[model samples]
Target: MMTFYNKQTTEQKEFYENLLSSLASLSKLFSSSDTPYLHYRAHEILFCYAFGANNISRGDVSFDATKDGVGIGLKTFLHGNGNTFQKIAEFNSVSDEIRELGSNHNDIAHFIADKRNERLTDTLSITSTKEMLYHVITRNNQSLNIAECRMSFVEKARIKKVTLKKNNIYFKDSLHEYNFSLAKNTLYKKFDISENILHSIDVNIMGNPFQLLENLSVFDTKESTKTMEIILPLYSTSTGDVGRSSGLNQWNASGRERHQDEVYIPIPSWIHNQFPDFFNYKGKTTPSFMVKLPNTDLVPFKVCQSGGKALMSNPNRLLGHWLLRDVLKLQAGQLATRQLLRQKDIDSVLVTKVEGKEYDYELDFLKYGSYEKFEESHKE
Candidate 1:
C-alpha cells in the first residue's frame, strides 16, 4: 500500500487550515443535536459543502456540485471507522432507482473518517481503502488458500450486486433531509473542481463538472509519480468521450516483461475529431503525438496515434489502464455508457455508442505475459 506524507506544503497548509475552520463551525452547529444519524449527516454535508458534492433523498448517491457535471455518482462512506457499513432502503425514491443504484458493486467510495480530535479544527484525513482480504479454505481434506486459488472470486465478494429485498434494512437514517451548511468557509472556499482528488470520486456534483484528470497518482507528491491509477472513468467536454477508449484495437506490444510497471490509456475516435492535427497520419505506421493533459504536470504521454485512434502505453508505467473490467465491475455487452458518467453529468456529452466490454491488464496478462500488452485479440 502506498502512503502519502501527513505534512502539508505552504499552499496545502493555507487551503486546509481554512477548510478545517469551516468544518469546525459546521461541526458545532450539527453537534447540538443528540441524534446519532445527524452526526453522520455532518460528514455527508461537509463533503457536499466543502467539495460541492450533494447527496440524494436518502444518501444513495452524491453528485458533483459543479455546473459541468460528471455523470458518475460517488459512493459515500462516513463514520469514525469504515471497516463496516450498512445499506438501507430509500423509501422516498422509486424502487427501480434504488435497485439500480444499490446493484452497482463498485468499491470506489469517497470515504470520510470523522475521527474526532480534541479540537474540531484539526486536519482530517480524506482517504480511500481498497477492500482486500485473504483467507484459507479446506475441501476434501485438502487445504486451499482461497485468494491464491481464485482471486476473482475473492474480488467479487467485496462488491454488492444483489437487489435490496424486504428485510434489507441496512441504513435507517435519513442524511439527505437535514440541510446544514451549503455556503463556503475557508475549506469550502479553497475547493476547486480541477483538483486531481475529484477524479477518483464516484459522486455527482451540482454544476459543470470539472474535466477528469487524464491520469491519477496514488500519492499527491511528485516523487511518487507513476504509482497513481485511474480508478474512475473521467468526462471531457471538449474531447466528448475521453477515457479507456472502448472499441479500439486491443493494444498488442512486445517486451511485456520489461513493461510490467507501465500504464495504458486509450484514445477513441471522438478524440481524433477534437484534435485532428495530432492524429492526421494516413500511413499504416503507429505514429507518436505529444500533447498536454488537464490538471496534471506530468510529462506528455507516449501516444500511439493510429487508425484515427490513439493509446498511451508508456513503457515506464506512467499511465495505468482503468481496471474496470479486470474486477468485473462492468460487463462487456451491457449499456455501460451510463456507468461511465455520473447520472447528472451525462448531458455534458452526446451519447453516440455504449461502452461495450474491453480488455484489462489482467486479461492481457493471461493472453500475453505482459500487463501492458495491447495485441488485438479476436473480438468475441
Candidate 2:
C-alpha cells in the first residue's frame, strides 16, 4: 500500500490535500476509460521475471527473452479482468515453441493483482496517479508479492500492425484504430482519447527468476491435469417489461419467465488441457454434473466446449426446475440475484459476475473439480 505524501510544511500539506480532494471529486465526469497502461507494463516486467528471463529486449522469437537458449514468452492478467491469456495466433512466429512453452507453463506467465482502494472506481473521472500493487499467485493458491510497480504515461499512437511487435507489450483493442504506447509497450484503444497519459513503470520484483519458473513447473506438468470440479454461477436479469425477452433464454424456454444476464467467461486452453474429461469428453456415461448453489442440492448440469472455452449448458430444466425456483426463490417483477459455484473442499467462492454487475467472470485456474464419485453416489 503506497501512501500519498511528501516533505512539506503544514500549509503546503493542506494545499496538497485540497488538490487531491478536488481531483477525486472531478474524476466522475468521464464515461469510460481504457485499461491502465501500468497494467501492460507490469505484465511485461512480471513475465520477464516469471520465465527466468532478465533484461528485456526485442526479438523475432515467441518469447520476449531467453534462458539458456529456451525461448520464454510472458502472458499476464489482472485479478478481476478475467483469466483468458491469449497469444494471437498470427503474432506467434515460432508457433511450436510458443505452444510448447504455453503447455509447459500452462500457457502463461500468469500473474494477478490485488484489489486496491486507489483503483479507478468511477468510469467517468480519469485523473489518478496511484501506483498499482500486485501479488503473484501460484496454481496451489499461494500468493506472494513478487512484483510491484509505479506507472507514467509516455504517448498514444495508431496501431498499424495486427501481429505483435518485439517491445510492444499492450494493445488496447482490435476494434480500435489508435492505441497508446509507453517507451516500447503498446496498447490499442477503441474509444476516442482526449490527452490520456502514456504509461510507464518502475518495477520491484522477487526471488531468483529461474527458481520462480521452476517452482511453477509442478502445475505445468502432465500429472497436474485431472478431472476436477468447477462451480459455474448463472445470474438472472435485473428488470424488464412484462413480455420482454429477459436474456435468460435457458430459463424462459423451459416455461419460466426469468430474464438472463449474459457473462463472457474465458475458457483458457490450459483449463481444457487439464480437465479434458469434463470439458472435451462427450458421452452419456459421464456422471450427473450437479451444480451446488447456495442452499440448494446439486442440480444437474452439462459441460460443453466451444473454441478454447467451456460453458455449463443447462439444456434441460436443471437450473429453472430446482436452483432458480427453489434455491434462488426468484419471482417475476423482482431483481434476480447472482448464484455461486463451489466445490467439495475448496474455500474459494466463484460467482458468475462479481459485484453483481454485467462484467465477465474471472475464471480462477487454481479452482477446478471432478464429479465422478458424486455421480456414483447418486446413481442409486
Q: If scored against the real structure, what TM-score would every candidate get?
A: 0.26, 0.23
Candidate 2: stretches off by over 4 Å: 2-132, 135-147, 150-179, 182-185, 188-254, 259-301, 304-310, 313-380
In the range 1-380, model 2's lDDT, one tens digit per residue, is 23112222456445433432332222223212222112334445544443333322221112233333232233333333222233211212123333453322212211000001111111001111123222221111111112222221211232234333343333322233322222212233232211221222222222233454467754545433223344321322122111122222233334644344321222333434554544444432233344433221233444443453334425445444332343223453333322222211111223222232222222221111222232234323
Clashes of each: 40, 21
- Candidate 1 residues lying further than 4 Å off, grouped into runs, are 1-15, 19-266, 275-300, 316-380
Model 2 accuracy (lDDT, Cα): 0.29
lDDT scores of the candidates, listed in order: 0.24, 0.29
* Candidate 1: clashing residue pairs, number: 40
Worst 10 residues of 1 by lDDT: 118-127
